[model samples]
Target: MKKLILSLTLAASVVASPALSQTVRIGTEGAYAPYNYVNDNGELAGYEIDLGNAMCAEAKLTCEFVTNEWDSIIPNLIAGNYDMIMAGMSITEDRKKTIAFSDEYYPAEPSRFMATAGAKFDFTALKGLKIGVQGATMHAAYAEENLAAGNTILSFETFDQAVADLAAGNIDLFLADGDPLNNVAEASKGAMVAVGEGIRIGDGMAVGLRQKDTDLAATLNKALTSLKKKGVVDKLIKVYFKDGPFYSN
Candidate 1:
């Protein structure tokens, strides 16, 4: 909750030397599907996981993933818990004040609102609706700023909780990144659907790093550029996101 309590100055002085020889610990929230998630085999698997592996290989750096709660992901990074964050975190200016970011791996797409199938609501006149969002997320900030004045914005700890609340009719709608929302809606047999035009917020998804980790950031950015040129980023996008290849020209 206290995001900026630790001063950037302290972070710089205390941050661990940008991991080079040691196995770089990449922290991720393994609960966000398609981005990073624990699969049925209890192994970390997802688009981010796959892409991270590719990036590390391209950078010629050894890296391993460690899962952390979303709300504390950045703080833990500042605390030197991990060297990088590849948790589908969007690159926002607000967040940039706290940490640096790599080049956009997942381009700025759009966020969507999910509701029960055929749920009718006016996009322009949105009112009297119970909107659910995971707390401490861009989607939460977006809903609070854009929708809370007219609607009841419910905050949950995780998107899955918000989805559960939507299924139970506790919330009229749920807002999130389009990928997982699409994944859920498609498998819902018309139980859920996306409403309104997509809303673009934040820059895009990128690797989160401590402000001091410029070398690691540069390494990842270079690796991401190479992968994009090789069509690897596009390939992963096609494999994980139906509407992607977002970073492609």
Candidate 2:
């Protein structure tokens, strides 16, 4: 009888092993609010977190969230530290060469410049100005390629730090996605304001996967398409953004 019970337990364990091993680990930067952030309760929370869970449900894969710094997010994924990234990372040609991207989950929100309230400058000729941007991002690339002629491009590890420098007058201008800048402007209470017209930057934001993981990328792309078709992505965007610049009507 004991042998029979042991055999049954072993069979159940064998049957459950694959389910346990099927978890898809997702990487994100817990610093970008509205998209992804560490909430007041110290848990990961935001649109991407909610959206990623939905995608996992649609894909029928168990999902695990892993917080990583923005600079290392891609390198860690390439190193097999996580199965995918859903960190509001934009899909760009340069990045596409290094990693695979799912179909855009979010539309291409425009990039904008934020400066201390009452600051002024020539957007056309920003030479000799100090511009802050988060390193390794499309914003950084844009600033370097277009705005770096005679400007001091200060690259920080996170957007919040760049905003901090802007607040302190340490930098002349800060360039970043409009979502975070909107959040900062509201929180700053007139300390900062969007300076110029939004600059169209990259394609859009999507899931980042290792180049060789085409199968996983396809799975994510299909799931994202379903989410878009079902209007779940739009609903989630409304829940977080609520008529904010990143959300369309």
Candidate 3:
């Protein structure tokens, strides 16, 4: 009888271990400053990184972040390389077809055109000039649809590269998030200035999860809502954006 009980206990432990050991792996573009950039020590740090750790602590789950490139973030998540994507990915109807999103965590920030001071042109007045955008981004899609059919469209793998090309006179304009463009503008020292009013691509960013994982999404939303109610989210934003390098750089 003792042998029989021991065997049953061992079987139960084997059956329950996987669920108990599950960890949430998050994919992020560790290059987007003030969002999820990598620090000098090679650790991911930013508003998203801080928020991700907060969510994990609230949900009582172990969390890890993997640096991922922007273009293939979703595909790699779908491939099971990670359980969630915490990059500042906009929640669009088109992206919803493949993956589910948690409730938005940030306010909608628009994308605008930026160019060197002397070369800045009215976006509406650009009869035929080049526009640079990061490849596979919603900015690229918006520019393609709204601009003239023959307008020069230059695509780069990273925003920094596109900014470099624009500064070098290889491209006439660049479309990117307002915050990052703010950084570029400062770096340009009066050379780069944001043009025309920006366009809202979608609501704020959200965490992406595989379809049918509605349970995790529900947990995340609840935890996030609780965190916001507790003022943790606001506090984090203030700490990082208010007096940090985000404003200066």
Best by TM-score: 2
Tell me each candidate's RMSD, in Å, in order: 10.4, 2.9, 5.6
Which of 2 and 3 is ahead in lDDT? 2
In candidate 3, position 204 carries an lDDT of 78
The alpha-carbon deviation from the true structure for residue 216 of candidate 1, after best TM-score superposition, in angstroms, is: 1.0
Candidate 1 is scored at a TM of 0.89
> Model 3, 80-149: lDDT tens per residue?
9999998878888878989999987765688878988877465556768888999877788787887747
Worst 10 residues of 3 by lDDT: 240-249
In TM-score terms, candidate 2 sits at 0.92
Across 117-192, the per-residue lDDT of candidate 1 in tens digits comes to: 8778888888999999998898889888889897999999877889999999999989999889999998888899
List runs of model 3 lying over 4 Å from the truth.
1-21, 243-249
Pull out the clashing pairs in model 3. Answer: none
Computed on alpha carbons, the lDDT of every model, listed in order, comes to 0.90, 0.90, 0.84
- Candidate 2 residue pairs in backbone clash: none
Best candidate, lDDT-wise?
2
